[model samples]
Target: MKSFQELGVSKSILKALDEIGFEQPTPIQEKAIPAVKSGQDVLGIAQTGTGKTAAYLMPIFGKLVKAEGVDPRAIVLVPTRELSMQVGEDIEELLTYSNLRYASVFGGVGWTKHAELIEPGIDVLVATPGRLWDLYRAGAVSFKKVKTLVIDEADRMLDMGFMPQIRKFLEVLPVKRQNLLFSATFPEKVEELSHEFLDFPLRVEVAPSATPAEKVSQYYVAVQNYRTKLNLVSHLLKDEETFKRVLVFCKTKEVAEGVFKVIKRKSEGEVKVLHSNKGQSSRINAINAFKNGEVRILISTDVSARGIDVSQISHVINFDMPQDYEDYVHRIGRTARANEKGTSISFIAEDELFHKDRIQELMRADIEEMPMPSEVEIIPISKKEKLAQLREIDKQKRENDPDFKGAFHEKKKREPRKHPTSFNPKSMKLRKGRKDGNNKKR
Candidate 1:
């Protein structure tokens, strides 16, 4: 409960924080600031929406009070282009009264344009791994002056297969630099990365790994199929006053598009969809519109789960359960942010029940089950959809028990197949006569 000042934040940064309305430090910030300020490598484990961005940024900003040198002195590597921009915005807000220069670089856009932005040099650089490597190889950036490196969302970076690029950065950077790695969940791969990336780093964990935000009220509605899930979402969103500024998460681009079309047909407010197939400008516009409250509902895949930083999101609807259990935490985290209370509703279909169970096991808690509203019609599952669900359930069962063959396998075994012989009836008769004659002779 200590103030940012008590955490030994510099006066200039304190004024900026005060202006930004950050009065007290979050648990992660309170514990992480001092450790980072001491110039020790830090490994922080906290869930999303817990002020983890500021936890590392404030201390780094305090240390780099004034801009110096031509090349960047500090680098913050993120997993997605959206996160790079969001972090860049945060840096701009925190450096309002300071002279530090920064630039955010990422792919999906021309590297030449970003190169021009960093031409005059920067004190801090926030970048995605691929674009950073591209710029470095093209001689648009340098890592000689890097004194501090922060790998935010380490688990997400690993998820996106950025380990090779990260290793390259580590190999080229100065060995004496400070390393700060932060993640919402620490899977085994992330742990292994930390060992290789950090040197005697001090560990700081504010909460248990994979734990959802405490302020979010979570519930799930049992759905029969995809169409039923859509019906439930449309029904709930009818309460416009209560479901304002919501995010609807789907597991794939096709599902997201389908949800967007359905919601757009019924919604009175603005609706948008985001996924990998979206063009860069489209994705940016969708995110900006959602953030500015111009869009009421944003149907998206997991791309925006950790990238968005909006605080007033009223609800997060999981249209489809995430295959990865850890993603459930990030998906729900999109709603409740900056200590604001929010709601998360998940639609658990028959096949997704296994995923729901895995998520509960990761969170160590069960999501409250809510009864379906009488007014909302529950569509009967189609035969094809029922078969798909059965197949998925069988796959999940096989994963849990290798010896247990699925229903399809048992069905195939029960129906015997007849083999055709090459010999005709005449050849069979001749062979039988010869055998009988031999027996009589004996």
Candidate 2:
């Protein structure tokens, strides 16, 4: 493996990297730095933990640090606020040896503060689409001086319906600027957008798109229901040796809150819940606590799965199976980062097995199933749980074979409404005659 210095990284930036204990470049960074430096548009395919942020940031810094710019030379577009913050922090760390201004602008916060920060001009601007667009409209940002435009997590941006905003940026920004599109997966929509956005881009991929990190040991435990899954999570966390610095992903905010309550009550360690329902400050606090080792467990929804950049995470627990198969990859990618071995344990109920099957199909590897721990008692499946399972199976069948509705699918029979005065033809004619007679008298 070649060192960062061998990749044309400057001594000053190398010093900063060394301070951060980054010695060798990861595969994505190793291959992408050159391509990014070459100034051609790049379509990079790499998972979250593959150092893709540094891949682009290194070359960007090498060029920007030498030049004097005021109007934001590089703009990185991220899908979520968390990602915007993560990428912004990476940029800050990379520029520790340089005197460059960078700001992370995202929603869930007032724009006035960000506007004030960027009004004086920024060298690097990391922002989400909505807030960036808002800033641009507010005349707080300028794209004329932007030399390089990066759309990180491009697939997620598309999934979140930021195509129009991205196109708006393309329309407003300088056409001569370089473009870099990075994503974990390139779905049809993402591919289509790349064609529209990039010009003859060099493609760099460290692994097949949507493939989970190989270092993550993935396993699933079958459970009876949500309660049992909670019990299992509580039981597993007792082994602090293996389940340190853990992230628990749920499919919904309510489930995440429930799991957080359960773990907080059962475990003696610090635990927090993160989701859209929580305030922005709370969410950020939860992430910081987890990252700083102040919190032992973080229960979150898919919102934080891909955006979190914490290192040394020992485990990722899927409290609920992700509805989107691609998310399973992102959830597990949270761990096994920085070439560290990590474990991913998923709690699967019978109803959620199909989701697991879809995830396995996407990864092209079946996760090993483990017997439930002896401490977790197998409670009888509740009727409500069984009905929910049936509904989920029905939903899956409908997705696969539209015509085959499951047993739980009962189309509501609508009773036709009856008009009080026009139930029959004779009554309708009499009403019409009375109306005509009244109009004639008037």
Candidate 3:
């Protein structure tokens, strides 16, 4: 329970922290700030919501705020554009009253805008690998003056195929700068990179890696198809007593919107969807509104699962299971923050069964299966209705299929060809017969 003031932070930083209501430091922050202040390399192992950004940012600010020249003394690298924006914003706020100059560089924005920021003496450069490399190639960056380097979300960089770019950045950057590596999980690749990058790094971990939130009550509901999933999700949301601010995550942007439409029908007007398919301003607005409690329900792809710094999220509903088990951890992490007990309810259908099982094994968590609501409450489709649909399918088959049950005269069914030859009109008149008079003779 050490306070930020007791951690040897200067009076100015203490004043700033107190103004921001940051009195006590979290476990990770308390342990890491001292090491980082001492200029020792740090390999931090902490989850996203544990105030990791501040754990590193506080120390960087404490050191860089008093810096004289702005030759990119500190470089903080993030994995995604959203994360780059978030971290840069966090730094900008803490350094608002100070004379420090910071820059945020990411893709999807014009390179010209970034060129102006980097050209000036930026004391702290918050960038992604791709843009950083691009700027370096254009001779707009001078890495020789960097004093501290941070690679936030190192595991994601490796996952997104940025190792080569990371290698190149390392090769070009100054050798004697401090390195800070932060990630929730330490895969083999991240561990290997830390060895190559950091010098005598001190490892600091506040929570066990890969462990889901304890405050998050997690369970799953079994269903049959997307239609069933939709029905189940809508039914779950109708119970206002349980779902307050629910976040539904799908694997892709299309599924996010698709599920959003299905759920919005029951929700009337409280539901909103966010995905990459939307324009940048739209997505940013949606996320901001959700974070501000303007939107109580948000349906999004797992892209928002990473580095979205929103607290007070009551429940996280998984409309579609995640492809990687690690994603399950990140998805649930969005909820159950700020010591607030939350729930992670997953909708497990036939298509998501395999993914659900793998996620279970990865987290080493035994998921309690929740039964669907009573048949009467949820209005299950009756057996008679299902049978009638099957009957209609059979009737359609009999009518449309001329040789439905007979063995194919040709061994292979006619499949759409990759590059089918053109059918000549003169040679395609009839198939060995004239049907008009020949059928009457038969």
Candidate 4:
């Protein structure tokens, strides 16, 4: 309940926050700002939409005071280009009353443009791991002036396989700089990363790691098959008044494209689809459109789940369960952001029930199951689809229990066949002759 002023935020930053209508600090910010100001390494565990970005940035801004050199004094590393852009925007907003220079660099655009961006010098630099490393190798940026290093969304960076680049950064950056690592969830791998990244860091957490936002009303609808899930989504969107802005998350690009096509044909609103394969400009435009309220619905894979920071998303629909249980938290976190109440509806097929159970276990709460709407058409599962579902279920079981050999595995087990070289034509002819002689004698 403490105000930003009471938390020891500077007068200029306070004015900027006030202009932006930010009256009070969120739980994470309230606890983290002071620890960060202490100049000790810090580890933060807070879900998305809890103002963790400001928790670190505000204190860092207070330390920077004014721009000093051409090279960046602080580097903020994120997992995706979208996140890099978002953090850069946040820095711009926070430094509204100051003269600090900052630049955001990521792939998808020409490196020359980014090189031009940092040429004049910047106080803060936000970038993805690969792009940052590339810029450094090209001699466009320097680490000697970087007094603070922030690895935001550490879990996502690890998930995206950026650990090697992160380690390389650790090797190249100054050892005397402050380290701040933040993540939505703290898995075993993240915990290991923390040990390597932080120096006796003070840990701050707003909630238990991986817990979904309490304000989000989570629900699930059981469906017969994939097509039925699509039917249910289209049917639910028919009530446009309640489902004003929605994010539909799929497990893969193909499924996201299918959902996008179905929703576009059935609904009368602008819809966009985003995946890794999409062109970078197209993906950025789609996200910007959705954020600006020009597009009502967006279908995307988990790649965009953690990067999106829109606060007014009315609903989050899981067209397909995420392969990683931790992603379920990030997907739902998209809706209930900025202390706004939101809803999350998941389509649970037979094959996804095991994943649903695992996610519920991680959240320590069950998602309310809803009866299928009477208007939605339920498509029957084909034999091929049914077999595929069974096989997927078997795979899930084997992942949890190595001793588990499901029915499909049992059926697939067969005796080894003879090699082509093992054929014997002479023996076959002799046996045939003996059989003919016996028949003639008879």
Candidate 5:
């Protein structure tokens, strides 16, 4: 029941908090502000939408109060451009009563304006890894005066392979600075990085690592194909009782586009899509539209959806199952946020049943399967057909090799890509084309 006032935060921050009606501090903010005021590194592992941003932000502002005007004193590294902007907005809300200035620098935007915003005293800098590194290498920004460093959503940085970049940033920055790492899920890598960046840090775990928010009611529906999964999703939405603000997850940009087209035709209105394949400006606009309630349902692939910060999602639907166990946790976490009850409905095809064991192991609970809805037609998969499907999958390896060109070229030295077991088999199936006369399965 701690208030922001009792947390020993700066009066300016308290004023801003009160003005914004954020009177009570969440568990993370209550614990994190003090450790940060002491200038100690803090490692906070908690679920998303528990007001995690304010947990690290208020304290950073508290430390930066040694001045009146803008001067860069803190650095927050995020995984994507959208997240960088979201963090900037959060900081702006917290510092409305103060004279703090923040610069959000990320790729794709014009460099001149970003350069002007970041250098020679921007006060607080929120940036994506690539843009920050580019600025650092170009001598446009300096970390010499950075008093605090925050790695928000540390798990995603690892997922996107930004560890080396993070390590490089750490190497360049002053070694004697306060470090904070926050994430919805704390995988082993997050803990390992904690030891490297934090010094006897005050660790805060408000929720267990990798656990979804409390408000979401979880369910997994077993199916046989993408079409079946889509049918189940459509049925849930059409069910009328639980169809508000649904967010759907797909694995790739191409697949997201395809599913979006299918669902857009299936739904009445309020359906939208966001993915990396779209231009950055379009993606930003789509997300803003979704946040503003213009779009009731947002269909997105993993990468583009990584930085979404919406808090009032009613349900999260996994149209295509994620390959990684951790991704599954994050996808479902979109709902049940901000202490509100949410429903996470997952569709598992029959062939994809193999992935269920791993997902169940991750959740530490058995996923209950609802019988196929009679009203929503579900086409059945015959055992004979499935066996024939497996045999075709087995025959594909020798028959299809795109690199061979004409089946007489020398072997290439390219290494194969690592795809998810569920999707990888499907990708291999596509690489092996159908039985056509001229269009051979090359």
Candidate 6:
């Protein structure tokens, strides 16, 4: 209910906010801006579309009145290049009236451009942990003046195994600085890392972590196998009236590409695929196409679950359920943004039902289940899919009992590694020595 100005935001930022049409602060922003301005480390937990990025940035910009130092004043460590770009763009939008400069450094691009950006010095730097560490180690960037260190998407950083990289940054950064850790979800591991990174940080939670947006309607369709799931996706996308501006999330890059191919062949709408395998330019183009409405459906892996900020996303279809339960919240968060109502449909294969139940348990709300359409053929499972399912089942068994070798484990252990008997070089020397000894004895 409070305006940005009422929340202690400066006149310049307020003017820029007005121009950007940010009429009022979101719940997380309302709570976080003050805490950040108080010069205390903050552990902020809110859903994806709640403007968490701006929450930290506004305060950082408010305090950073000018570009004073050759080194960056604030360093925002993100988990992905897409998020680095997103945060950088958000900062640029908020700096409409300020002379402060910020650069987004991430992998999948030439370091030359980033070196050039860092050489001139900037007030803020948004970066992925690995690339940022690389730049700093290469002496292309400095953090001596970095008074504020932000670990955005801390949970995702842990998921992507960037804790080591983040730790490296912590080692190199000044100890006498403010630390802010923000995340959509706070699993135990993420919480542990937050404790390690922060110094008596003020905990801020606008909504319970793993809680999906209330405005988004969630549903799931039961399918027998991967092919059936693809059929279901194709069927749903055909209904353009409701599924406009849709986003489909797959569990892996292979699944994402498969879904994209199937949808491209079956549906008449424009479609794009996004995954780690895609080139940076292709990923950017796909995201731009989706944002600009050039593409009606965007199929992607979990990579885009947190980075994308497209409003009016009519639907987010989980072509494959996310392995991480927290990612379910982010996948659905893609829709129902900016106070708009949206829908999310998930395709649950028989093997993925347990994952679905885990997600529901985390959300404390069961996703409404819908029957698969009769017309959509339940295709026979391919050998590859069958093997994948077996592997998943084996993995689950192993999780319950570490001693449980997988379905293929016994076969692998029993199978003999072949070595040619006639060409045993290891014994040939002994045989020759024995023959020589026999000759000498004779």
Q: What is the lDDT of candidate 4?
A: 0.92
Model 1 off-target regions past 4 Å? Answer: 410-442
- Looking at model 3, report the run of 10 residues with the lowest lDDT sum: 402-411
TM-score of each: 0.93, 0.91, 0.82, 0.94, 0.84, 0.88
The candidate scoring highest on lDDT is 4
- Over 4 Å off in model 4, which ranges? 410-442
Which digits, one per residue and each the tens of the lDDT, describe model 6 over residues 9-121? Answer: 97778888899888989999999999999999999999989899999999998899877767899989898888888888888888888888889999988787899988887
- lDDT of all predictions, in order shown? 0.90, 0.88, 0.79, 0.92, 0.78, 0.87
- 177-257, model 5: which lDDT tens digit per residue? 888989878889888888887889888888777676667787877677656666777767764445778898887877777
Between which residue pairs do clashes occur in model 1? none
lDDT of 5 at 245: 85
The candidate, 4 or 5, that scores higher on TM-score is 4
Quote the lDDT for 83 in model 3: 86
What candidate 2 gets wrong by more than 4 Å, as runs, is: 403-405, 409-442
Highest-scoring model, TM-score: 4
The deviation in Å at residue 79 for candidate 6 is 0.9
lDDT of 2 by residue, 1-442 (tens): 8889889998779999999999899999999999999999999999879999999999998888653656899999999988988888887788888877889999998998899988876888999999999988998888889999999998889888899889888889998999999999877888999899899999999998889998999999988797788789998988887788999999998888888888999887899988888888988898888899999999889966557899999999998888878888989999999999999999998878888998888888889999998878677888988888888878888888978967876789999997586456654434233544564422
Model 3 agreement with the true structure over 326-429: per-residue lDDT tens digits: 77888888888767788888887544666677777777787778888874144465666556545544554555585664322225678976954796778665
Clashing pairs in 3: none
Ranking according to lDDT, highest score first: 4, 1, 2, 6, 3, 5
Compute the lDDT for candidate 5. Answer: 0.78
N/CA/C clash count, model 2 = 0
